[model samples]
Target: MSIVAVLNTKGGVGKTTTALNLAVGRALQGRNVLAVDADRQGSLLAALSNRGEREPCIAVAQYVEGQALRQQVLRAAALYDDIVIDAGGRDNTALRAALLLADKVIIPFLPRSFDIWSLDDMSALLVEARAIKHVDAYALLTMSDARGTDNEAAGQAVPDDMQLLPTTVGRRKAFADAGGAGLSVLELPAHRDSKAMAETQALLAAIFN
Candidate 1:
């Protein structure tokens, strides 16, 4: 089994959205997925509840304490093919705990200056964590603007310790539309933007490959 933790010390970077979509995507592909909500706000669980019966069911567990979180993940590993953890957007106990158990770590960030600057701190944390664990960590660019900013140049600035994914999720109405109703962007109807769906699928492919 593989455990993936979606985390970023800075909030509003679409970390929960990414984690939710990843869990649902894997479930759609017939993998037994378990989503762990480590954030104090419980946004992940709330999103799953809002999902209703529209999307594939994903098992969920909540663990906030660092040691407890690690123990829960270790125990759940035998029951699911994949575990996706939604951790708080800070260098908190929950995030550190998830990092300890995660087979892979995903750090989603916006391409803006402030968000870009935050990666330095995250990179340092990841570097230290990796030294004590065997985990593949990546930096994913999300909420990318198609206008004004140079996405490519921005991606190049990712720290060498973390690999930057090739596909980026652009800021689009489909994301908001789907999230509002607790649905994965992939589950959006035919009228939805194909680019949004395509970007999500590309990320999933990269994640699982």
Candidate 2:
């Protein structure tokens, strides 16, 4: 089994959005995927509940403390083919706990100066994480402007110590719409092959391949 954590030290960088979409996308591909919500905000699980969706199709579990989080993730690894964690947007215990268990970590950042600035802080965290575990980490631009070159510029600014993913998710209404309906951009009836879906698929491929 493979375990991945979707994280960023800064909030509102689309951590939950990335976690949910990745979980659903993998499940659609016939994987036994389990999404773990390690955030106290419970944003990951809330997204599905708010839209009245439930599983067997996509299993979810919430555990916030470091000990419990690590224990649960380790146990679930034996049963699920894939595990995706939505870590809290802070350098807190939950995030640390996840880093200990994850095989790879995906950090999402918005394409703004302030967001790019936070990458320094996130870099420090990743450094500490890598020192203790053999975890592969990458940063992906999320909620990027579709019309401007800001995303490209931001990608260049990312620290060389941190890996930056080529695939980026633009600021599209389809993301919010699909999240509201408790579906992934790929799971949406129409726009199944739209830019949003393509971006999501690219991220999944980058992470899983």
Expressed as tens digits, the lDDT of each residue in 88-146 for candidate 1 is 67898889888878888999989888888888978878877878977788999998988
lDDT of model number 1: 0.87
**Cα lDDT tens digits for candidate 2, 1-209:** 89999988899999989999999999989899988999999888877666454443788889989899998888878899999999967888999988878888888999999899988987888788889878788898999886878988999999877799979898888888888766898877654548888899999999999
Report the C-alpha displacement of residue 18, candidate 1, in angstroms: 0.4
Clash count list over all predictions: 0, 0
Q: Point out where model 2 deviates above 4 Å.
A: 50-56
Cα lDDT, model 1, residue 73: 90
Clashing residue pairs, backbone N/CA/C < 3 A, model 1? none
Which ranges in model 1 have alpha carbons more than 4 Å from their true place?
A: none
What local lDDT does model 1 show for residue 139? 92
